[model samples]
Target: MSMGTQGAGAGLTRPAPATRAALLVLLVGAACLLLGPRLPWLVEWPAGWTVPATDWVGAALEWLLGGIKPVARGFSEMLRYPMDWADAALAVTPWPLVIGLVTALGWAIGGAPMAALGAVGLGFVLASGYWVQSMNTLALVAVSVPLALVLGMGIGILANEVPRLRGPVQVLLDVMQTVPTFAYLTPLLLLFGFGPVVGLIASAIYAAPPMARNVLLGLERVDSQIKEAAIMSGGSRLQQLFQVEIPSAGTQIMVGVNQCLMAALSMVIIAAVIGGFDDIGWEVLLTMRKAQFGQSLLAGLVIVAFAVIIDRMSAALASERNRQDQRVTAGLVLLAVAVTALFWRSLPDPAGFTLLAPVAEAVDRGLGAFTAANGATLDAIKNGAMFYGLLPLRIGLDDAVLEFTWGFQWTPAMSLALYALAAAGGLVLAFAGRATAGALLVIAVGILETGVANLAWPFVLTGAAALAWLAQGRKLALIVTLLLLTILLSGLFPRALLSLYLSGAAVFACALFGGAIGLVCAVSPLAWRMMRPICDMLQTIPLFVFLIPVLMFFQIGEFSAFLAICAYAIVPMIRYTRHGLVSTPTEMLEAATASGATAWQTMRDVRAPYAAPTILLGLNQTILYAFAMLVIAALIGTTGLGQSIYLALGQADVGLGISAGAAMAILALIADRLVQGFAEERRRALGL
Candidate 1:
């Protein structure tokens, strides 16, 4: 009786942690809001607070570069050597030989149909009077793809073993993958200066992470059954890893390489923006700037064609059937292309080729008329977005956040109280398992603290790192913190929130449309067969390509941005969900069937739970994809951190650009962590 009474008394005295946390958050938030308005200093970032940290970073980079100037030059020169050789060689190389070479590669890798497409694509570029430029882009991709794959493999291999580093590495990769191409110029400029080398360096850096990530995933997924068999056969660690694990993981690695190839090609244009290689990317940008829609469309189509050819070939090579046989043939074809590219100067041109010139022109003309025909409709759509969506979103979210952070009107004591309250709230969140929220709250408090708050950022970062180490055993809390910090510092926290507000709506939209399509197709094998190729094709098309038509139809507004993001990011959602459903273990389905479950019940109870992680992965990819396009869509008037990055890049303001990059990175990380965390937990419970 005494023990029971004591237990009851203890239970009454100690409330649930979640309940306590919620109560504290509510009380603190209420107090801050009520008193915060009166406290100017507490509400807004005060003046005279600044960090020369960027300058320090620049200096450090300069010092490092200067120390390795000689080696840097050598590396730069070595990379340029092949590019220069290809340019000169292609200028004189016979069109027939060039066409035949690509055709052979396509034939060897993907069979006759792909070979024919390759021929058409190569011939079209040659005849269109852009052979030289096309070749330049091609060579860049050829070289960069291999380098990225190799480097990615090396790094992924090393990183996978360092358990503590895995989280931080992933955070870095996620950030890098989505960062705007222009932002990288800051670091590359410091290292390689301006030229094709700059583009090469940037392309490799940008493309490697995906390959690395895929490599890691591939290795982790290698079947323990196969590995154990190798061990029983007395295979050494290195032998088993090389002869067994690597071979088994070929498909994933190939997927990474294919993505790397596409990314490298996409960056060619961006790199040209800042004096890299003179290729299709530059021409595409130039024609667009001149408003020559037909010509720009032509160039864009050519890029798409090239992307298609590469994607198809890579996919065929990675397929289960004839994998070993395909490898040797593919290798030979690639070697032939590279070797032929080397002798470009020796081979005479077949006097102004006869291939895609006419087709390209017709397509260009058709696209021009298409856009023109819809001009009125597009204009109306644009107006609707700007007036209806953009303005309201900006005013309600952006203005509201900024106003609170700025302390629009408040007395000195009120400001101090508001600042103190924000600090306390942030502190509580930090300790209460919502590190992201805590960091944002504290940063708000520090902004209110202004001059001194700027200095406090370092400590905030330290605290986040320390806290992460304590809680998660050294994942990437610092990077997660920095991401939010960047958004705050870039003066875009308000806009960033608004960006998320829009992205959230967009994601929900994708969930509905994409999820429906995927689920419907998954239920029918024949429908899945048809849709799978279509999805794969759509996945190959770059986000920028989607923007051209979206901008035309939507007429350059927030809605255009939203539409583009949806189309670009929705593929992953549909693809992942369908793949998960289709790939569900047969045994589970049988068990559910044995239990007298209907199809829907099996999906909900058996397949859905089994496939949740994959679907969540799709969700994660969708968010990242949406954010990736966020910067590009800014050109159409989407207001947010993306716009800030664009403006900063234009002004050459490194600090502003980096901050925006960091903010976007954190936003992505937060969404990723949320979905990934839940998915991981579910998978663990399901023993998957």
Candidate 2:
């Protein structure tokens, strides 16, 4: 019995598999660092070693596209008819009638609030002097949304009906969601040869996944008893699906509709980059390029107005509340008709209405004045962040710590001192039984000293594998290793690193600030009240519009892009963090109180641990958001795979665009998997 007890104790004292992996990773990193100076290949990938994967991808796609170009063009031509009809219908419709129709529809879908939203939102659009441009955009959305709905619904139904297809369908959707918006434009541009057709198709493709996902969710959530009842009622599978299951899932399907509308609208605007349509998005782009900041803001607002109206109206459909009276809707429509008919001859063209144009001009002048006045201050902030923060992360201390920038040149001796300090701290942590954290601290210091872009390939792989292994098990670690290896072989590894660096920097900034704000919001209801609307507005606005405000203050640069990414990505962090913290169970709080815990102590010891998985998921979302915005930021001024994708879009290089997109997607997938793994582990530990 004594010998058995000793064996059990010894077994319990052994380090976990994760700890062992971390130690192995640390050893690999240390070896790489020590030998790196003598081995150039350790610091950078050798050119001779990279496969010409991009060229091969290009060749394969060119051949494939050559075979399918005729069919694709035929389909494009087929799609053109509805797009043209929709465009002409909206174009010819009188502005008043259109506004009235939207208001009435809003009433039918929601109530007075939605009706008012429709009226005021459309009123702003009409007043912005971009009414004609807005019409062009609306027409594109009008046609593309239905196409997306049908395609997405069909996919969802098929996936639900066929179990084997579900996994593949889901995987495809994940890829679609992670791939940057601009990446879709390249191959489509090649297929369609530069037209609104490309935007139409791209918007449809981009917008479909949300609907498909929601449809699948809705169908799956239908009560099993309901399914049995339908079967007992002698309903055919088709009848059950279409008449019973679908109607039963109306709320979720409506939610899908809302997402589909928002996505289509956002994509249509982004597709303006292709420049075949005279939509509001194109107007914003045109004015922005001309340095007409005021006009750009106005056009962007028009897009925003449209987004809000569409979002609110569709969202209301998912609500259980009864819609407003039909008589009110009819009265509004009649009023619009009467007004249009009575003033038909004297009515001003909507395009000629420049009520907001003066405001726009003033805004432009004000922005100019503000920038001019604060030019020195802005420059200082920008330079300070770049020199102290982003530059170091990108290029490392050895390169970035220059006499002019950091006021001291980094020497080899300083590097040794940094490593020594890290080692000491790591040892202390290890002694405290936090071996993994200690090892991670040393690895982080090494990364900071070497810089992300200059990281040795083997070190990066080992670190990633360690994280994955700790997060889940061997399978995830191996998967991450293989995926990263593909990027390494693609010749796009350097650009991938740059992309990783920028997105990582933005995510770090977001997590730090966003977590603090969320904590404060959790502690104070008034703070949450103030923040809630701001979060809602930020989320409501499309990703493209985010660039405008950042660009207005900072102009075009990496700093501007970073700020844009943070602004867009920070919402989820704030929301999820607050939610996780505030959602601590009442019993747990009571238990802490009974144990004589103070409010702060309860929060620190009880709330935070329970919220760990939730917070990690929030961080996961922030990471993805950062990557999505990273590509859009490329339009202003950014380097990395985003730039490659954007350049490929312009050049119509299908190979480079797809390959770079895949690399970006791979990076995002890796981050997503690792975070999710950790969150899953936490959940399992809590038996949740």
- For all candidates in order, the CA lDDT equals 0.68, 0.91
Per-residue alpha-carbon lDDT of model 1 for 92-139, expressed as tens digits?
665656777777777676666777888887766765666767877777
CA-RMSD of model 2 = 2.4
Q: Please give the distance, in angstroms, between residue 210's alpha carbon in candidate 1 and its true position after superposition.
A: 2.9
How large is the C-alpha RMSD of every model relative to the true structure? 8.4, 2.4
Model 1: lDDT equals: 0.68
Q: What is candidate 2's lDDT per residue for 50-95, written digit by digit as tens?
A: 9989899889988888889999999999999999999999988889
What number of backbone clashes does candidate 1 have, counting pairs of residues 3 or more apart or in separate chains?
Answer: 8
